[model samples]
Every structure is written in structure tokens, then in C-alpha cells.
Target: MKMFGKVDVGGGLSDFWAYIREPRPHRWAVWGVALALTWVVFSGVEQYLIPVDRPKAQIIYFENWTADRSAGEIRADWIARARETTRRNARKRAEYQRFADSLGIEYDSTEADRVTRETLGEEAAEAVKQRPAPPPRSTLAERAARGPQPEITD
Candidate 1:
């Protein structure tokens, strides 16, 4: 019923504004402290309270139909890729060697290539040795004995 009644609110805000408007020796100091406090509060909220939703990395995978290929075909393709990679690396090394020569820096391209090839070969051998064995193949008779498998529904 008393919507327009005079409520006694403290003059804290008015007093603060008055102090801000009035110039004094410690006015700048107060302003600096206020700014520092504001910065601290905002930085704290940004660093902790705000939920930062970083955009998720979108990964697109292209389907490679290499599974249906024969072992010989795969090996041939791998060898071709290896040769192309070696050629590209050799070209890069030659360019770098030329740059080094221009800069009066000693760079032995042959030695670098030799070392790289040796290390690459060693790693390739290690990888081949560490390769997992192929899964065991099941015969038709075994499948018949096991009976029909349940249909997979999405």
C-alpha cells in the first residue's frame, strides 16, 4: 500500500561519489587501488568462474580402401612411397647444403644422407619386427559348428 514511502537508505554511495569527485592528495592512490581491485576481480572471474568453451578440434578421416589389396601390391606401393620420400629429402638436403655453403657453414650432405638412411633403415627393421601377428582365420566348418550369430541392430 505504501509504494512511494520515504525509505531511509544510507548515503554510502553518495559519499563515495563525493569522495571520488573531490580532489585530494590520496585521491589518485584511491583510484589506483580501486582500478587494481577491479582488475583482480575481473581476472579472477575470467580465469576461474567463467566457463571457457574451447572449440573442439574437428577431425576428418578419408576412407582408404587398402584392405582389399594383395601383399605384393602393398609392398610395391610402400617401396614407391619410400623412394619418393628419399628423393624429396635428398632435394631438401641439397638445398640446405647450398644455403650452408653460401653462409660459409660446413655441411656434409652425403654424410647426413648416409646417417639418415641408416637410422631410417634401422627404425624400419625395428618396426617390422615389432609388427603384430595377423588374426587367426576361421574355417566355414567352425562357423557352422558355432551356429548363426545374432543380428547387430543399430
Candidate 2:
């Protein structure tokens, strides 16, 4: 006997081939019938039960919350709101005008009416420079006339 045993790979594969050569015709027919029945059942269920696709715009809906409001009511409300805003703006403008006036800025309308450097001249500037500086001291009589200063307890 040889040391290595003879392998029979070819014989095993040929046996498998011979089994496939002898086929059962009924097996293919049974598989075909099962596939046909499954397809028919699925198609029938999909046709009647499932909804068709539609545009998103048509499917979504919205209702106006202001539908019950009358035209006159809307007009009146807008007019009142506008009047309030106008009043606030006018008050702010008036306050700014007052502050500007306190700062010695004249609101001259015409270019000819506006004050200029030539009007004051060099003589007025000289006179201002020659005027003596006032004393820093505040007299007791002056303080008394103005009334007593408020006392801070803290």
C-alpha cells in the first residue's frame, strides 16, 4: 500500500451532476404558481386600499383668523395707532428744540439774517479781552439772599 491515500474528488462532483440531470418537472410548475399568486394579491391590495399621490400645496390648508373683522374697524385701529406715533415724535422734536435754544444756538431762517464774524468786528473782541475777571468770592449777603443751603444728614 502507498503512504498517501488516493483522493476521489472527480467522482464526488460527477455524482452531484448526475442528480441534477434527473429533474422533477412538477417542482418548477409549483414555484411558478406561487410567484403568480403572490403578485396578484399584492396588486389587488395596492389598487383599492392605497391613496394616490397629490401636490403638497393642495393637501395643506389655512384659515384667516381676522375673517370676522370689519373694514371700518381695521381702518379705525390703524388710524389710532398712527396718531399715537405722531404725537410721540412731535414731543421728542419739541424737547430737542428746547435744548438747542438753551445752548444759545439761533434757528435763523434766511442766509442774510444769520449772524457773522464781520458783525462782531475787531473792536468787540478787544473790549472782551480788556474786561477784568470777576472775583471768585461769594458774599454772605448773596448766600443769605439766595436762602440757606440744604443740609445733608448723611
Candidate 3:
């Protein structure tokens, strides 16, 4: 006994063509259902199986902590950091200016630089103004004398 009949690929295709060519509303409905099913299956596979683009984990260093540094040293470090930040911003501005020039865009570099400096100065002043004053030594002694207090709960 033959396990399989002769493969008739063109016959199957012709039968499919005939089925599609029939003037039946159900055929279009079946086609729409098939399309929807296929879309759902592909979407499920893509959602569950495919690897998506993701942002890589970043390691950010905010500052180098020093225990023995004086206030003068801290002030100097802040000044240096400010200067570096200004230099970096200026360099970026210059690069942008060059790019704009290449694209025939009118950019006033001097004016931009002046505005940037003014913004940076204002930010620095605001930060300094907002700096919290250290608690007085007497206040610290009083807190120490009070010891640990009971935690407040709602």
C-alpha cells in the first residue's frame, strides 16, 4: 500500500485559485479571518520571542568624595568644575555653529555665547543661594542629648 499519493502542487494551486474566484461573500470573510489570524499569530511570536532594543545600564560617577579636604579645597574644585563645564559648553556651541554655517543657517555665535554665560552665571548664583546653612553646634548638642526618639506612625 502506497503511504502517499503523487504530489500535485499545481493542482492544489489551481483549486485555491478556483475557490478564490468564486463569487461568494463568505470567501472574502474567510480571507479576512485568515489575515487577522495570521497577523495575531505573527504579533504574538514577535512580542514573546523577539528581542527588543533597550537602553544599556549606565554607571554615573557624581563626585570623588574626600574626608580630609578643607573648605578652600572644595571651593577650588567647584571653580575648576565650573570652568570645565564652561569650556565644554563653548566647544559644543562652536561645533553647532560650524554645522549651522555649513547648512547656510545664520547663527550669531557671540550672542549665543553671551546668553549661555549669563544662564550659567544665574544658575551658579541660584545654587549658591539655595545652599543650606550648617546647624549650630548647640543645636547638635541638644539633639544628641535627646537621644533616639520614637518613630511616628500614621
Query: Across residues 1-154, which tens digit of lDDT does each residue of candidate 1 receive?
Result: 9975875456767887787798788988887999999999999999899979999999998977566899999888888787677657765776776677666576655565665556466654454345344345576899999999999999
Q: Candidate 1 lDDT (Cα, whole model)?
A: 0.71
- Candidate 3: where is the Cα deviation over 4 Å? 1-63, 115-154
Q: What is the lDDT of residue 113 in candidate 3?
A: 60
User: After aligning candidate 2 to the native by TM-score, how far in Å is the CA of 2 from where it should be?
Assistant: 97
Q: Write the per-residue lDDT of candidate 3 for residues 1-154, one digit (tens) a residue.
A: 7755688889989999997798986887898999999999999999888969889999997867788999999998898787788767766866776677666567666665665566476664454345344333445678889998899999
Highest-lDDT candidate: 3
- Rank all candidate structures by their TM-score, best first, as comma-separated numbers: 1, 3, 2
Q: Model 2 clash pairs?
A: none
Q: In candidate 1, which residue ranges exceed 4 Å CA deviation?
A: 1-44, 47-51, 57-61, 112-154
> Whole-model Cα lDDT per candidate?
0.71, 0.60, 0.73
Q: Model 2 over residues 1-154: C-alpha lDDT tens digits? A: 8755887889979997787567787867876999999999899889867867866765657874478889998887787676566446544544554555656455432232122113334653453345344335566788889997899997
lDDT over C-alpha atoms for residue 25 of model 2:
75
In angstroms, how far off is 18's CA in candidate 1? 29
Error of 1 at 150 (Å): 94
The weakest ten consecutive residues by lDDT in model 1 span: 127-136
- Tell me, by TM-score, which candidate is best: 1
